[model samples]
Target chain A: MASSEEFNLDEYILHHLTDSQEWHLPFLPTIHLPEWLSLHGVMLLLSSFFLTLLFGILYKKEQRVPKGLTNLLESFIIFVRDDISIKYLGKEDGRKMAPLFCNFFFFILMLNIMGLIPLFSTATSNINITAGLAIITLTFMIFGAIYKNGIKGFFKAFIPSGVPAPVLILLIPIEIAGLFIKAFALTIRLFANMLAGHIVIISLLGLIIIIGKVALPAIFLAVGIYILEVLVAFLQAYIFTLLSAMFIGQMLHPDH
Target chain B: MTAATFATIGAGLVTVGAGIGIGLIAGRAMDGISRQPEATNKIQTAMIIAAALIEGVAFFCAVICFMALGK
Candidate 1:
């Protein structure tokens, strides 16, 4: 176990929050290996395992009517399917894409919620995790667009129909850049939201230590921020999944 | 200024931008919701998602600031 003195609050928070990755330095002499496994990776696995267990328990009973945890889970699943997936991707496409979107939504939701738990870290707080998700969505968008519109149609969609030949030259690049920027934005957005919430909470708490025990107002501020952070936990998760669906929807029917 | 102070500033700017973006989104969503109460669920849901996306960007900015401060 690490000593308390060796790991202060800032260090403790940073240590828990950092990712574990192996880096190579072919041209350089030093490459630091992170001391801890990526919290996001662990949470990803844990959420998957929990989802499996929940499904297994539900299946084992073979209950015709939903009850208890199963019912709650069913409602969430239905909400994603009906509201997010179906509403965005449409019935036929949504049905096909349901599992992917469902997984994405629940996985992100669980990860966001994890930060709220004491002594646990949030996976979604990590940039790599959010970037990975954004990349996956980007890939789906690209492939889905190609599949729907064909390669010729896909490229053609980049140029707005009303633009003249001369303007098309500039518009096409701008449009392409816009597509990439949107995906890049998604990555930064998720990473920033999750990280900021924790930081605010930490900074608020840090005030007690910085200003000493007599700072009663700081304590109240910290408590208030904590409550806001709780709302943020849910809000961030909802936003991440919603933007993802919107991106997918745009790619699916670009003409709109 | 110390790295930590710089980070604090950077994080502050990010949140400010996010606050503005969210305010706009919420304003529009509220307008829609008020006009059509029947579509409140849909509007609210869309608003929440848009808010998250904006928040995500702010979150990214915060993380970068943290890293800068730590170093």
Candidate 2:
């Protein structure tokens, strides 16, 4: 880390945004971790740890009527079951997939909220993590469709039934591309949203370092964005979970 | 112009496209809410989903433009 007098805005912002094996604190020694242990990996592990602890603590409370944390968590699960999965997916199947949807929502929500903490980096901001999650959704989409309608039906899905023969060639390619693009878009959506939020916060904070005391008012703007980031964290998690369920539901009930 | 210049312009253009889409969604959602008043929850959910999908494409292009700047 450089002294404030020799501050570099680009390097500072990029440093805070990108993942690395080393953790650097301003005016402190840089702590280097093992090659396999990266910063984003650490954040991911921390979030997962917290998630498990939360669920573990809640698992034992056997009140017939849910209250406190149990009540709140139950409400969120019900929302996912009723509003997301059940709304897009059928009743039986949506209930079956509720646990998976719950996992996706809370895991992502944990990562997003944890990232806002001062010492933590955002794992979702990494393209690889988001891509991995998107790939799971894509796999479920393709496989769910296959399971529902068999292998022939999956292929038949690309070609609308009773369509003219010549149009098949053009339509098939477009349909296939559409499937992949949707998955790709899912990947970018989470990654870009988290990354962009962090970038804006860091950039605004950096103004104080790059410039002088004249930039003090920028802190309030940064705080304003920070509050918005809190909302976005929840929103992005909900959107990701909702869209994933929607994609799988579309495959299960393909009209065209 | 250099690649960075084009990259910046491309990112700006992506914002323009997505901005209009989200604006339209917001406007219609507002209109629908005002007209029906009872369907606000459904309308708001639909609006967010549609806006998020459109923003996904915008961010995809923006990510490419950003990578170009690194080149």
Candidate 3:
């Protein structure tokens, strides 16, 4: 982008879309590492570390009638546990999965909020990151299904009970496919929402460059969008966590 | 018109449809809440879920439109 003399929208958008920087192992000469490190991945690791360290320090300061930042953070934790995890995942399983739900909610919330900040890239905006999160969710769902039902019972999920012999053949494949579809939906939902929000913001700003004379109105519109993007950041994080819990709940106690 | 123009038009068409679908969901949800203010939370929750589902479909269309741009 910097190399080109004339500004191109395609290059501008593509530049913003791509990971700008990455890090790789320098010491391991013999070991092969894939294109593993990226801006989003680094941000993810930073947020994870921040969450852990913050929570670790906060854990020691716990008191009755929680106060200050601790109170606010605790409320968030309780909300995720009760509203998201327990509400969807059920009392028994939800209680067991509360820690995980809190982690998912906080981790995503951190990443989404960070993305809004100037100069920081959105980790969740990356499909790979969101897909990784969705896969973790799917793994939880699968394990929950197996734990609730035996191995045979788990496979039996693909075929609904009391179905016609011929219908079973068609139903089984569809049901199995549905399992992956759910995860894919989860991945796309988060990734697309995050990505679209940024794209919209960048495009709005680009309007100023495209129409140089009407910069004032375009700037105003872009500012409005920036605020909405802040709200969307939180909303998307919450939605992702809530849907993951619901998917896990459905698997834990299959209604069909 | 070039493929890019068509892709832009297609995306606009998709947005038109999605806007109506989401608007319908939101309008009904608002009506329901107005009729029964006590059930506002429930209505809002249902509205969000429906809107998200509709938005998901719109996003799928958007992905197709994006692919069309490349071709």
- Per-residue lDDT of B15-63 in model 1, one digit per residue for the tens? 7898999999999998998999999987887787767666656766766
Return whichever of 1 and 3 wins on DockQ: 1
- Fnat of every candidate, listed in order: 0.89, 0.89, 0.16
Q: Provide the lDDT at A193 for model 1.
A: 66
Q: Estimate each model's TM-score.
A: 0.80, 0.95, 0.88
**Residues A1-256 of candidate 2: C-alpha lDDT, one tens digit per residue:** 4888777787777777889988765568878879999999888888989988988886546889988888898889899999999999889889999998999999999999988987677899999999999999999889988998899888877878888999998889999898998898999999999999999998998888778699999999999999999999999999999999998888887872
Query: What are the per-model DockQ values?
Result: 0.61, 0.91, 0.57
Worst ten in a row by lDDT for model 1 chain A: A22-31
Q: What is the C-alpha RMSD of each candidate to the true structure, in Å?
A: 6.4, 1.8, 4.8
Worst 10 residues of 2 chain A by lDDT: A22-31
Instruction: Write the residue-wise lDDT of candidate 1 on A1-256 in tens digits.
Output: 3543453677655654566453323456534445675445666777778777767765335668978877887887888788778888778888888788778877777777766776456778777888898898899889988999899878877878876899988888998897888888888877766776676677766666656677657768877877887777666665666677878888887787
DockQ-sorted candidate list, best first: 2, 1, 3
Cα lDDT over the full model 2: 0.90
Clash number by candidate, in order: 8, 0, 0
Which candidate order results from sorting by TM-score in descending order?
A: 2, 3, 1
Ranked by lDDT, top first = 2, 3, 1
Q: Give the residue spans of candidate 3 off by over 4 A.
A: A1-5, A22-36, A58-61, A161-166
Name every residue pair that clashes in candidate 3. Answer: none
- Model 1 ranges off by over 4 Å: A1-12, A20-39, A58-61, A216-223, B1-14, B53-71
What CAPRI class is candidate 3?
A: medium
